[model samples]
Target: MNKWPVFCLALSAFLVPTAGAAGQDVQAGQILYDKWCAGCHGFDGAGDGYAADYMLPRPRDFTLGIYQIRTTSNGSLPTDEDLVHVIDKGMPGTAMPGWEAKFSSSQINDVAAYIKTFSPFFEREGAPDPLEFGRQPRREGIAEGREFFEQIECFKCHGDAGRGDGPSAPTLQDDLDFPIRAADLTENWNFNGGGSVEDIYRRLRTGMDGSPMPSFSDLIDAQFMTEEQLWHVAQYVHSLSPEEGPTISDVIVARRFEGDLPASPNDSLWNQAEAFYIPMVGQIIADERWFAPSVDGLWVSAAHNDEQLALLIVWHDPSESPDPKWLEWQQSVAASMFPLLDSVGVTPLPDRLTVQFPTSIPTGRDRPYFLMGDARNPVYLWQWSSQGDVVPEATATGLGNVQPRRGESRTLASSAVWHQGEWRLQFGRSLATPDSEAELQFATGELIPIAFYAWDGSNGEQGSQRAVSSWYGIHLEQPTPPSVYLSPVIAMALTVGLGLLVVWRAQRREEG
Candidate 1:
């Protein structure tokens, strides 16, 4: 037999059921399952509900019996209590509705019992071996236990060393990205609901809703584990230290940029300048005629290698002039040297400012490049390099002409022209009403999207009768280096320790 499998089987024999599991109610549980859950989870416990296909993550396929999320020991079955809890709490942002008030406590308990019947591994026995079953007790002699932490996906978010600083930390923001913190497995105290082994098991079994965690109940249904596997994985996760901190690289500083536009006449010549500001504002727009005057615009800040910045402008004029003013305004504005404003988070490095309105331009090294207007209009071309030299104008994508309805919105697409090192791009949008909004991706290339916000009127401004008046800019670039944390370290240590033990044991056997 494989030494690893033998060791696991030997270590878990102790989890065999006591008299408590031999008694009452497997059939009673079945009756309840048919009444309450058969509609979605199927009579056979396979997730094949009429509505299951429509769900994004897909409904639980209990027939496979592999639970994706739970607080129980890895490979071991979830306790009866674990099943009961999820039915009551209800999953957030999903079709799973809570049964806390809908079903009585007894009904919920019955349903929990019924769920276990679908998975052959679901045991109503004594808890698995805490060392081999619960969290691999961070015991001194159990070398393989530590190694098990990394084999599973524990270190992906929770740092390798049991800290919570995994590589995906920055993207897990508070607002846009669910403020998810990989469990600091080593800290013990930071455990969300509770620090006990069962508590952790529950999280794994049910999977936290609204977060990346997924329920693992179906994993058990798949016959992936025979009781022993579940217990071992859970024990490994539990053994990790929870108090791990982040390394310097994991530290991040959020920043913004600003600038001002020079005053211009209200004529068709200002179309370039006015078009440049379309993405800046949410409402209002320049009439169709180019060169027809009056434009509303503002200046925005400059950026460093790893920062994100954007400008928003909203125009509401509907009058059509034979001589368009928006295009002219866009050209005049993008050509200005002072277009790049102050720093939003980092200090501005000294570099020449090249303004290119509508033409596509070549970017030099990695310093920074600017995406001016729409690619079609070749109004102005410019570049800013570290040596403080203004490179002559190049082909540029001029500003786009966007005329949305009273409650409509439109987006402008432009290339992230390469500058010094990384590429840069810009987008313009016009919102005709307060409730109007638009989202545009700079390009579908290898880029990290940055979220931006801007407002033209009061907090609750209403353009009920007026055109949409709001705009947003999405910044794209490769993600910056990530900060290090302890979770990964602990997980790595555990995995390496297990592998070494396996090798060492083999050598000892040969010597014997």
Candidate 2:
């Protein structure tokens, strides 16, 4: 697991020199912006272009100028270099594309100045000095940084391991009081602040606006540490990037809750349950991993009440669908106009996730293979499709016996929400399904064999091309109060003690 420094919301404000962008031509920038940016950002920069509505994170409404990412404090505007950097590299995991290849450095600098024109905030900017980054990264600095990380309690929100599953993760909120998740330090690609060492340092120094990541500048009063210590901590954070897959246990039992159950994927209550990440490697059947996957693994947690069972599955994706549905028409037009593009792939992707279980709980230790199952054994597959709004259950006797479920069943329902670059899918079903052989049932304590398959529509994964997993047992783990089992043990002990006493008396009497 990667260790992420707490999200930093840095000091109140700072000044930065225009430096390289000074005296750039705004008119030239406007022309470039119109050619490259107006299609999505709108001519007025209000983020209301024809393409903006279809964008996952709608194009930035520059008029508001409330940038989510910045080196400046919460309310301050980003520096010119900040804007130029974003344009040059492009924001990864978003619809934005880098202009560095298409435009010269001078053109990019001019466009950077033009982007500021949409918002008057930059006009009032007073010159501020760029933040001072002390010494270069060194091994000696890392040790000192570790001390600062612990001293400031960065472990509380980012977790001791920096996996972002800290004790306070579920309850973390932004300045707007909206529930916000801490950054999963391992997935460097999704870092909105950028992932370079300098980027990490800037994120730590400036902090993310509205997030729990507070800047340590003020916190680091000389008594606490020096400026170099802050840089060392940033380097330390960079080093903590997740090197391997998360720890996955062979057996995972569901935590049980009483009365009401969590309905949404983001519910804070779900955090109480034991989280086991089922990585693609752990779950994917060896013979079948045909294509390279866009994702490495998935996050999973399960909970059960008296009647309902909920499974929350989370995985990362760059696009919600295989490609933007909104752009399909345009893509077709371009393809038709250009015959040379005949070989260009236009995928028909159906994003979906499937869960498989033995049609009936397996007997003894024998269980079916994790795939669709063999002809000798059958499995029930409950499928959730991104295209379909409903949760339909299917039963497959083997790889070819895929059939729709018939008749009313005990339970099946699901809900999902997509946020940031991750999709949180929640599925619910009943503990028992009419006590029938055709349905898969769950008992309070007994283990049930379960397997998962996920399809990334955007990646053109379909049929067997999808990611698969080995079988993992799922069981409801009801909480046991200390005395529930303790009293029985105590009684048994006393009963054994009395019997021993009687035996000893008889032996003694006989000897006498």
Best by TM-score: 2
lDDT of 1 by residue, 1-512 (tens): 56998888777655532122435345566666777667767788877765443232345667555553344555544555656666786644234667898877876776676676666765434235322223433333223435545655555666566555455532343211223345546545435455556566556555654456555555666875433455455556666633332221111121211232212222222233312222221222322211111212222222212322222222221111111222232222222211252221122212122332211111211111122235333233223232223223233332232222222231322222322111132322221213222222222111221211221111111111112212112222224333433333333333323322332354356335
Q: RMSD of candidate 2 to the true fold?
A: 21.4
Query: What are the TM-scores, per candidate, against the unseen true structure?
Result: 0.31, 0.48
Worst 10 residues of 1 by lDDT: 456-465
- Residue 484 lDDT, candidate 1, scale 0-100: 39
Give per-residue CA lDDT, model 2, range 100-131, as digits (tens): 99999889989888778788777777325556
TM-score between model 2 and native: 0.48
* Model 2 lowest lDDT segment of ten: 7-16
Find the candidate with the highest lDDT and give its number: 2
Candidate 1 has what TM-score?
A: 0.31
